[model samples]
Target: MNRQAQAVVLLLLGGAVLKASFTDLYLRYVKEGLRPFLIAAALVLVVAAVMTLWYDLRPAATAEPDEDHGHDHGHGHGTGGGHHEPRVGWLLILPVLGLLLIAPPALGSYAAGQAGTALASQQVSDYPPLPDGDPVRVAMLDYASRALFDKGQSIGDRRVVLTGFVAGGGPGGEPILARMILSCCAADGRPIKLGMAGNAPTGLAEDTWIEVTGRYSDRVAKDPVNEADIPYVTVESWREVPVPKQQYE
Candidate 1:
């Protein structure tokens, strides 16, 4: 790409990062803690772009005598000044265009289905009691970990709330609730799925966000792709919810 294209790419990339950082959109691609860094990095890109434009628009440097070649044929390094850049450099425009024109959804069921279930890396067999809420709001990963690892003692006799998007499961490809976990970005995202049983909503399309109030259950099923055990939730009530500001945990 020429210097003009390069500057535009830098400007566009910086603008995209600024846009994501200013809104909740960045949460879809990265963890919350990275927001400040993203802003800083974007500022740097913007500065670099401004500098490039300045240099490109400045008056041309005085042409030195073609001392080596006697005359300037300008055919490249025969006594050359021309340089070649790989055509692959143009591919950078694709991502710039994608970020500008496309508002991609957060990683949802399809991404979850493609990867193995990601649990907390730390191994903890003990868990504290659930806080005193009839249907305590529990994070999806926390519920999954406690359910599978601690044997559900922490959740004993309590209905808990889980917020996530719908994924297909159970009989006849019914909807199940799932929240994705992202360690870094969407590329590393995966889900902790809860197979819903009682009163689970039907006919929900994939990626429809929902809040489920459910009691813990002992039912478990092996993930078809990874063979990891997926725990169950005996859903008592559920309703569609707007997608959270931060889509991943």
Candidate 2:
């Protein structure tokens, strides 16, 4: 391929990658720390383009034209070029294509209890009663923060919306232990626990994406292992969904 063509192919490939959900992960994890890597990748394509142009501009190599084949060597797939033809870099495209085709599942049990853990020490007195019929949407992080900030207060029957990746469940799952991603910082993160309600989507597993809509109850739900200290939320509705590109964006 010529220099212009190579550049155009690379540019298109990059644009497709940018459109993918994995691109968000790339920005979060790789872009922040690897400015030089991006620069180097660009520079490599530039060099390939320049080489292609130079090859095209130079005198064409002449091979004997055959009567039947009619310029077999000269007018073959080879355009104005040196002895070499540009090779498609499939290896470079492989990973990018894989990510675009199939996004990996969200962080599972390994990072479940660890990431965005809900607060367990909220006090009973601070929570206000749930309004008559208002639908409240609150980020898991925010809810966790409120719990920590007003441990002395009660988070009464207020309708709240929580979003996060699923986590903290076994193969044979329980209604509780749903997970959510916090801000970039896991320490500040919070995952709300749902009390056994209606059957959750069975096919979905931990680290699956979901949105949980429910009213907060003042009653504290504790973990069985540590009955003394467990934070829980009584769930009214749980719905599985695609993981949003921006978990904390």
The local distance difference test score of each candidate is 0.82, 0.51
**Model 2: residues with Cα > 4 Å off, grouped in runs:** 1-13, 21-91, 108-133, 152-154, 163-166, 170-174, 177-179, 182-213, 217-230, 236-249
> In model 2, how large is the Cα lDDT of residue 143?
56
Pairs that clash in candidate 1: 76-80, 77-80
The candidate scoring highest on lDDT is 1
Total clashing pairs for each candidate: 2, 13
| Cα RMSD for candidates in order | 3.8, 10.3
Q: Show model 1 residue runs off by greater than 4 Å.
A: 59-84, 120-122, 170-174
Candidate 2 lDDT over 1-249, as tens digits, reads: 444555555654554444542345444333233445655665665566566667757886765546537766547876555542346643555665765675654444445454333445544445454335556776564554444445414455566776765555422345344554444433343445443343344555666777777654434444543332334455678787776755541
Give the TM-score of each candidate: 0.83, 0.45
Candidate 2 accuracy as lDDT: 0.51
lDDT of 1 by residue, 97-140 (tens): 77767888888888877776775354677988888878799999
Write down the worst ten-residue block by lDDT for model 2: 26-35
